[model samples]
Target: MKGRLFLIPVTLGSPDYRYVIPEKVLEIIISLRKFIVEDIRSARRFLRMIDPRFPIDESEFMILNKHTDYKDLDGMMSFLKEGSDTGLMSEAGIPGVADPGSDLVLQAHENGFRVIPLIGPSSIYLALMSSGLNGQNFAFNGYLPIKRADRIREIKNLQTMARRGQSQIFMETPYRNMKLLEDIAATLDNNIYLCIAANITHPDEYITTRTVSDWLKKGFPDIDKKPAIFIIGIKS
Candidate 1:
């Protein structure tokens, strides 16, 4: 019999895992001894934070990141043939969404393994729910181009999509959050609504939806070095 794969969701930023992570999920995490994580150090830290008694030394961790090649995936699923249940964890939030774990999950499915997704905080969905924009139709664009010309074009494309009643969602590296914000403010129409959600689930969490014109008038917030999600759409 093939072992099952559990999709684990780590806390967004709050130090207390209990607040964002469910007890049922924690129970399943406690039962697993093997894991495929995006980052080894953060995965270990999260496990220890969830339960101090968690057997960090006894558990095995396989790294899956941008550099992981197709050949490496076979080894990631090796424990499943032995009927050992394995967990998949991302650096933060749920695995498989804007996460590298999606490739592993696809491999598991191909090998006839059961994939179970546990409930947890997703910054994208969280931002969408709070944005007061069109939830029925939305597109997660992942990331815009880093180059100024290309980024402006991408912004225009997203705005065009939004004009058609589809909400556009995207994210950027923490260090580049301010630059992206500037681009959005300058490139988008003044009447378009933009939501900036920063440090989601953390004490410093900030989420607001306002017109681009209003945002320009008030100036951008201090979102430097903080994880954030940006949504562009017309207010409903």
Candidate 2:
């Protein structure tokens, strides 16, 4: 009998998991003895935060990240192949979305393992909810180009889609957030609205939506070196 796979979600730097993670989900996280995680240190830290008495030293862990070799994915299923249920956890937020956890999930499915996704805070959805943008039809454009020239063109293309009523959602590495915001201010159309959601679910959380022109005149908060979500879409 092959074991099932549980997708674990972690807090968004809130420290208080009770608000974002379900009690049952925390219980499931505590029950697991083996895990496939993006970062071993942070995963262990999250488990410890969930329950101080959790058997950290005894728990088995396999590192899975963007750097993980594809050839080694099948080997990650060894525990499941042995009928031992394992959990797949992300550094933050839920597993799979915009994270390397999706690769392992795909391997698990192809190997015939039951996959269970637990309910938890998703920054993408949360940002959309508060951004006052089109929630029904939207696309998550994970990350834009690193080069300024390439990024400007990408933002323009996404803005074009926004005019048609489909929201364009994207994010950037924490350190580069300020640069991305500056580019958005200069490149995005003033008529369309722009939303910048930073430090989501954290104590210093900030989410705001306004016209590009308004933002340019009023300026905005300092979101430098912070995790953020940027959305460009029509208000109506």
lDDT of 1 by residue, 75-181 (tens): 99987878999999999999999988999999999999999999889999999999999999999999889999999999999999999989999999999999888
Which consecutive 10 residues in model 1 have the weakest lDDT in total? 13-22
lDDT of 2 by residue, 1-236 (tens): 88999999899888589999989888998999999999999999899889999999999999999999999998999989999999999989999999998989999999999999999989999999999999999999999999999999999999999999999999999999888888988898788899999999889999999999989989978999998999989977
Counting clashing residue pairs in each candidate, in order, gives: 0, 0
How high is each candidate's TM-score? 0.98, 0.98
**Residue 38: error of model 1 in Å?**
1.0
Off by more than 4 A, model 2? none
